[model samples]
Target: MTATQTKKALLNKIECAYMPVSDPGVSAEWYERVLGLKLRSPVKPGSGAIMIMGGGQWLFLLPSPGMTPLTFETTGWAGEGESFEMFPLCFETDDIAALHASLAESGTWTEAAVRDEGGCGLQLDFKDPDGNKYQAWQPPAQKGE
Candidate 1:
């Protein structure tokens, strides 16, 4: 109960992410088959469906008339002259190599081969059926071997 003391921050974590898709049913199926997210509800033509990730986060795929994909380009992250297309969402994985192989076998659109990023560890970038860009990251192995 001091003046210098501040209350705890209200937000702790993100629970859900909303994405615009051309077709809810198709997107839902793609997520389930490709990324292993389970559909929480039945999909309708013009409606949205809730997809649950293994980490318990909900992804809502909503039908969009514009069909705009979720992605943006930035020069800041990649340095001054180079431009890098950033993925809004980055999912953590234990095995980046296996996931890369699976994505390739499925003919998914991946930016490039999985590479080590020093402090960031291994990273793989890929696009969904709707062209939404996303990244998968594998943390560096702990030192103790």
Candidate 2:
């Protein structure tokens, strides 16, 4: 054997991703409808002064604990003030079509469509009205074209 790598990296699971919104409750409701994630609990109940006040692992609903929405100085941010950055949060799924349909059924998807990004992969994106973006992707086929 040589210095060449023999082992590989493996991943288990991703627990959550959180985003900030002006209102947590309302945002949570939207996520539940769009992504099919349940609002099981909150990291903090009344975190913001806003009506749907909360903070936890909610997509565009609330910030993660100790993490607020980005400010002007945050580095590597491709977005303008409150606009979506190029690097949006992505959710991986084997069933992109089903996910898109699920989102469409609820009518909460701002823009959910499937497109082929020049063999980057099969991808679909949906944006919440708040400007938060989420993506579902399937890798390019390794075995067959």
Candidate 3:
């Protein structure tokens, strides 16, 4: 069998995105600021936030109705690779340098950019106020972009 057919057998594209952001607004903003994705559903009156790419992915960021907002605006043990950290939110950006500049100006105290072991991807690390790690990356859309 060809390599292309092998990949088709094993890999499925991400059908949809489901995330629990302590604050939908903050998560939506971060996705925009870093990944350049416009949130499909803004925080409208009596409506929660749902973000969608123009293509096929939709991420629902459900925040508690009355809970205080939380985002990866702070730093601590979250990005330190602690096993207790659990899941980290990973996003893809078309331009990593631009996103990095924006994050630097954001002044929310984010982690430094790191290159992955793989040749093509770059990661900018940060932890939200809730200590949930969020990383933005670029150049690895299809195994090696």
Candidate 4:
């Protein structure tokens, strides 16, 4: 395929993101309870499961050899210092403050308070049982829509 055709043919949408977890059941339960994600399939002890996060996105909770889950982190535009983040699995919401408040009251593990991202969005960092950080983002409302 030519460059233009290839670019056009390429489906840029991300289907699912693979999240390495110590246990699929545990992670799946956490995602469902904390993030309100629906399980797309039933997962067994050694197997993984697909979760629907709405908007054509999915989370694949796969098993990993390491008992410990990796710490998800990110940095600012400078990209020098590291900050806690679930890089591979950032979630979106329409109302960030409500979500943050709900999660805070839900008794889940919230890593930090919500941050105002200027023109980007509102960000709230949280985590699962294995220290895998996740973020909730609410984009700025469009003007004169």
Candidate 5:
């Protein structure tokens, strides 16, 4: 197969997202109370918190020294000031408006309005207590909807 026509199998879906935070315990509680993420496991001696998304996807919050949230934003596309995205831990949402309102009322959301990416649906970015950035994305509808 040529370089542009290689017939390789596609990789499987993502199993989990590793989030670096200043404190695992505090971040875990914020994710639980604010984002409604249930605690899958407590912080271990050397490990971190494990949270489960709706579709059984795992989110691991590990401790890291001098860890900081990404400064740029994304809608699955390139833009100025955008970084490598080092895994922003995007959560798929069914109701972006409701989620946005809730996060806004909590006074923790980073942005005021959701970005409506024409074909990609809506997205809202927010940060945790430790400044770990995250996103909630609502995928576009399929044809015949």
Candidate 6:
């Protein structure tokens, strides 16, 4: 331990995340129907919407004109020379298989298969109707369970 370093972190936890959408009302419904997020606020055509995730995190969808999807591209994550689209938001799930099935039934775009990332557990990447990329992770089961 360093004398200058404090044990307490300056930040507590991430309370919310914001994403740009073409229509807040439509996007809010998609989030609620496909991802099971609860709409916490009334959404008008031009107004923003607040959604509550299973873990109590807040996701705000704001209407923006000509807004790009909240995603970025990098090369090294997938391997050298292979570009990979990275998502700013990574959600946690308990049942990856069921979620995958649900996404499929909804006709959502997703990676062909769920990947086992070893110590990082199972992972699946998908996109919203607006093309906002997101990742879902299912932690590896505990040894005793």
Root-mean-square deviation of every model? 2.4, 7.9, 6.9, 3.6, 3.6, 2.0
lDDT agreement with native, every candidate: 0.88, 0.57, 0.62, 0.75, 0.77, 0.90
Backbone clashes in model 3: 5
**lDDT tens digits, residue span 33-145, model 5:** 77778889767766789988778888888988888764454455555555444335677998888877777777785678989987989888787777777778999877898
Model 1, 101-140: lDDT tens digits are: 7778778798569989988899999988888899999998
Candidate 6: 10-residue stretch with minimal lDDT: 40-49
**Which tens-of-lDDT digit does each residue in 1-145 have in candidate 4?**
6766644455776777888888899889877876778998889778997888868688888898875555544566235675634445577898777777667777777745788888987887776676666677888778874
* Candidate 2 residue-wise lDDT, 1-145, digit = tens: 5689676658665445556665666667666666666666653665521222122333335544553433223344435544433435666666677777877887755354777766687787676645555567777767665
Cα RMSD, model 6? 2.0
Tell how far residue 92 is off in model 5, in angstroms: 1.4
TM-score of each: 0.87, 0.54, 0.58, 0.74, 0.76, 0.90
Query: Which regions of candidate 5 deviate over 4 angstroms?
Result: 70-87, 141-145
Best by lDDT: 6
> Which digits, one per residue and each the tens of the lDDT, describe model 3 over residues 14-44?
7665565567777678767754567885586
- The global Cα lDDT (0 to 1) of model 5 is 0.77
Instruction: Choose the strongest candidate by TM-score.
Output: 6
Ranking by lDDT: 6, 1, 5, 4, 3, 2
Off by over 4 Å in 6: 1-8
Q: What is the lDDT of residue 65 in candidate 6?
A: 95
Error of 3 at 7 (Å): 12
